[model samples]
Target chain A: MRTILSVLLGVIAVTTAPPALAALNVFACEPEWGALVTELGGDKVSVYVATTGRQDPHQIQARPSLIAQARKADLTVCTGAELEIGWMPMVERSAANARIQPGAPGAFEAASHVRLLEIPARLDRAEGDIHASGNPHIQTDPRNILTVAKPLSDKLAELDPANAAYYDNRHADFVHRWTQALQRWQAEAAPLKGVPVAVQHKSWVYFFDWTGLREIVALEPKPGIPPSSGYLAQVLEQVRREPVKMVIRAAYEDPRPSEFLSEQAKIPAVELPFTVGGTDGAGDLFSLYDDTLHRLLEALGHDSSKP
Target chain B: MNTTRFVIAACAAIGALSCPGTGFAASDQELKEIQQQIQALKSEYEEKIKSLEARLEAAEQAARAAEAKAAAAQTGVAAATPPPAPPPPAQPVAPAAAGAFNPAISAVLLGTFGQFSRNPDKARIPGFELGPDAGAGERGFSLNESEVDLAANIDQALYGSLVIALQPDNTVNVEEGYLQTTSLPWGFTVKAGRFFSGIGYLNEQHIHAWDFVDAPLPYRALLNTQYGDDGGQVRWLAPTDWFLEFGGEAFRGDAFPAANGPGHGKGAGSLFVHSGGDIGESSSWLAGLSYLQTRAGDRVTGADVFSGRDHIGIASLVYKWAPQGNPTQRNLILTGEFFHGLEEGTFDGNRFDQWRDGWYLQGVYQFMPRWRIGFRHDELDSDRLAGVFAGGTLDNLGHVPRRNTALLEFDTSEFARFRLQYTRDDADLTTDDEVLLTYNVTYGPHGAHRF
Candidate 1:
């Protein structure tokens, strides 16, 4: 009996070697945030991504499965610049989890930390369609990702205090690689030197600034307006006259206008990854830059190494 | 290859123009640079058109254009459906996922079951429900679903779902039809193909989309025979969250139960107005009124006797509130509506009064996270006229039918439901006792967000 008890005790100690730690259940509304969580948490947290990166976050339908994911999540992070206003309210209700209620610590609206652009002169629900507060595409700006990293690491620590230092160290390592990559991107974009571009929608502002590309014209006469034939013709006329290098847009935007212009005028259209994993070729965060910058350079025919 | 030839010609021209002092090494680099630029341009076109084109509607158009350059690029859908249904057994989706494009399409498809019988009153199939359960039903599946739902994001801003039902016969049916959109500027949206009208909350929703699995009887009466409007609609939301919608649709081309006209007259148009957004922390409401008119195009209604069309108006008040903090998570809904329809417009010159009124008070209480119980009381004051077969007067067979129902539902999940209902039907046409027991289940992927 003594021999058996001692052996069992040894096995129990071995199994219980790791300190009892509360499991982290995190919900990321978009795939980019999910990737970030994966990079930072490693094995310390469990993550659920509400929408795939390929999907436009603004137009998600509140499906029951998504709500279920929300229900079980301990922390819910959304790219909330009112980007998900159409469906997030419904997703939140469907999840039936009261812990991650908006304005609650368990819920993080990532856009809150970043500076917003295109602030409407007058804000009202009556103004057709409007983002009541901010534009939520901050993930495209890697700097914002770095800025939010501190908070994410801190939140993870609060949830699992035992691994606080480990989370901090990971954030530091991410900063190093992320900065290095950004420097290279900035240098490569130099030839893009104030090259004029036309954007189909307002999604590419941060990316345009980061790359030093100037947006000479926008297709939409008004925000969110579906391009009319007249508008397409007008844009073609403008491009034929101006010094525009390429027409840019996010993935999932309508391609009809781009094609019409590309055919009518010879300006090539460039579709960039709006979020990480927006394309299979652009899998993770770092590689996403490689894909985007490469596409831009290729559109301008600036990649001198290719044969 | 043509571009390659152009590059070679340009290189030769450059060599002839260059000064003898310029080195061959510099000229060689320039030629190589031109070649590289051409290749880069080619790659950019290829990547945008083939790989990421599916992401943008415009990119898709460009991709289709690019596809023409390659004989193998048959269609814009890609050379091969990139994400093939991952080898069946390990696939996450049901093999027979009804409709491929939209959950709304499948919602109508899976929820509907119909029959053509010599006797219009009774059903040839014993297993399915035909009439009086959902409203004006005649020997067909109610297609009115009470369910659990799931949906996954397809591309940015677009979602897909499947609805599963719970009820007698334990059948499944589609509740939503075709495309649905919530992202639009200036608070506007568009829906195309077969989908429920946005006249009232109940009419726009599936039984599974409701807090109570069974819809109130009046909603059924008003929307009977016309749950889904097959054309398209445009909705505009005002700054005050007030919504104005103008919609028109063609009727289902069902062979039997034909329309009142000869050539495809079965189409409808509607005008709706309402406001959205929460009223406060504890309550929210959607108040609206709508008018719907349908011309009997599908029917070959007896020409001289019943050749005309129909019109209906719905005024609804939907109030939602919670005694606790969460309104939808736990709440009470009080809804009331009055509907009126006119028939025999083409057959008879005279216009008679055809009015039906329905009202309900319902409440849902969540006892736990995944489980909840809902109860409702509904009564409809109906005046449905059944004309004489041979020939009839305005006074013949016109009776006021009053029905009251008590329904109990258990929500297994917000998107899935199991319901049991008993109704007491008293009508001028019948004096007999009527008792009914009904069960229904429904669900959609992320079905919680349709409202």
Candidate 2:
């Protein structure tokens, strides 16, 4: 009986003990949010990013490591226009963490801070996979980042009140640098304004809205559906009639469809780093837009305006 | 002289009363003053009108600018950080008010067309006493049980879900009804009411989430397809870098393996531990061990009845791989489970003691999007009983039951799937070759599946 009692005590001690670090732990669902938290929290917090920039944000599995990280998280940051609907709910339930459940102080949804685009006028499965709340790919626009940053910083401070001032200062600095970068990108991408382009997927709607680019056609027949050769034929005909300058696709997307169109219609196939760490040039949040603009301008056959 | 004076007076009177086309009423200097005054008044009125028009233009421009700003705000195009104490952010567009409080509802539809080389009624594992819910499904075209689920947050701290299975024979069963705590501290969660036991890897998953059309032979013989009962479960997720979980459950034992027992007190209990981690960005694996103990007063299996104490243990392993953590293109999943069972008691008024074991290994490979092929192998062994149990229900018949199955599946989308499966069964003395085509589709808001 004494040995059994000692065994129980040892198990309890091992399970109940917390990590040694004093920093607040955060779990981010996507790479962009991870980068943002790192920039704002700096050394005050430890961030665990669930998915990489090359991963599809819409389709993620609730892997075991993600649940473990969520169990230790003081806060969870996710793009929550049902973007993480496929796996986030499962991870939260499995983690058994009381702090990060929805409607809790530790839960922060970036989509709630910004207005969503492409809200469907009608809801139906016939339209393929649709987000009734709107398109969840909000990170393609830099301005949405500015909007999500404020609420995120406030949430960080609210969860870790000891570093409220520190969080605020870091957030203010990010805003200053981000606003300047946005202006530079705008100036560099002026030639891309109204430049008609065909896209492999609707993943770049936010980017098009920011750069004033017009979408002539999409390679996919519908959202989340891969295009067959027949559908590509139709898309090619449409682009030919509309006479677009280039075809665009994300770095993570399959290159086949866009390449096929580019070959059929004598146009360049441009691949943009959709998020941070998607490419060598997009190493951080700032360079994400810088690399994106440089790629778009390069496709237009113009020299990059900046180093 | 008097006439001339009268005429002059008349002319002066006429001029004062009415001047018609005559240059006799005013002087040139007075005319010039009137013209200059009229020009000055017209210019003053023109200047006032111009100022009013300019003000209207400025007001219109200001209104247009304000509208543009509102449009930008609606789309979240604010270039600067929102001011402190900004207006509460507008929530994602909510469902219609009428359904705001409604629980999430989903329904699963399943149908199967099965063909067999031998009579399915004569099907038996020879050595194993099949549970009531075990054995082959209905022959020919038939609609299997349709499951409807409703889940909602009971409160800030609890979540509740109910699943009802509708059988084709006009019967309904409550498959699962449980309430779970969502706000438990220290990585602990509690579930109460009727629920599937969390002992095995696939026990808690619903039929719609299965990789194959039917449960494996081991599951059928050992767990009666699946083990679920009125129970309370407690699980703890350890705070570690790897996924480690420990759970225990106590059941009233009104369902299978243990039946005809008192309605109160624990008739069966189980303990389980699971650990898992990712190999890298592309590979992940989970392993688990479980033990279940049951005290049966009167257990009925097929036409035979037995009262005994049963001990069962299970071990499961699962591995999954997707290139670069992206499964939309291609992936593979491999799963295996082993079960060991021991029973001792009276069967048909005779003392009986027997041991049984089974194992199954399966792998599914998605070579391309929406297409998958899978293969599974199962084998079961039993210890031949002696004396009164020989040639009885506990008899092994000196045979080792084995089966092989292969399947092909096509998923039209995330919500619908169609599968074709072929199984060669050698469980009985005669081999049975079976073919089945099945369709599974879901409607409404289905919750995300667990890994």
Put down candidate 1 lDDT per residue, B1-451, tens digits, no spaces: 7656655755665664685567544566766776676677667668767756566877778888776765354444433432211111211223343345443322212243333222234211111111233332224455444454455544433334444554446655454445545334433456665566777657776643555434565554444433554567776533221222334444453212224322554556677765443453355566677876665542332233333455667777766555322332245556666665554443354444444455666655555333455555555453434543212323324444454555555543332345544444442244323322233433222223453
Docking class of 1: incorrect
TM-score of chain A, model number 1: 0.87
Query: lDDT tens string, model 2, B1-451?
Result: 5335444544554563487467666556655654555456557668988999999999999999998988778557434543222223456556677567899898999999999898887788877888888877768999988999998888889989999999888799999999999889999999999999998888888988989988888788878889999989999998888888899999988777777657434388999999999998899999999998887776777678888777889999999998888887788999999999898888887877788899999999999878999999999998998787777767878988898999999987878999999999898878999999999999786358467
- Model 2 clash tally, residue pairs: 0
Clash pairs (backbone) in predicted model 2: none
Report the error of model 1 at residue B342, Å.
Answer: 27
Q: Chain B vs. true chain B: TM-score for each candidate?
A: 0.55, 0.80
- The models' CA-based lDDT, in order, is 0.57, 0.85
lDDT value, candidate 2, whole model: 0.85
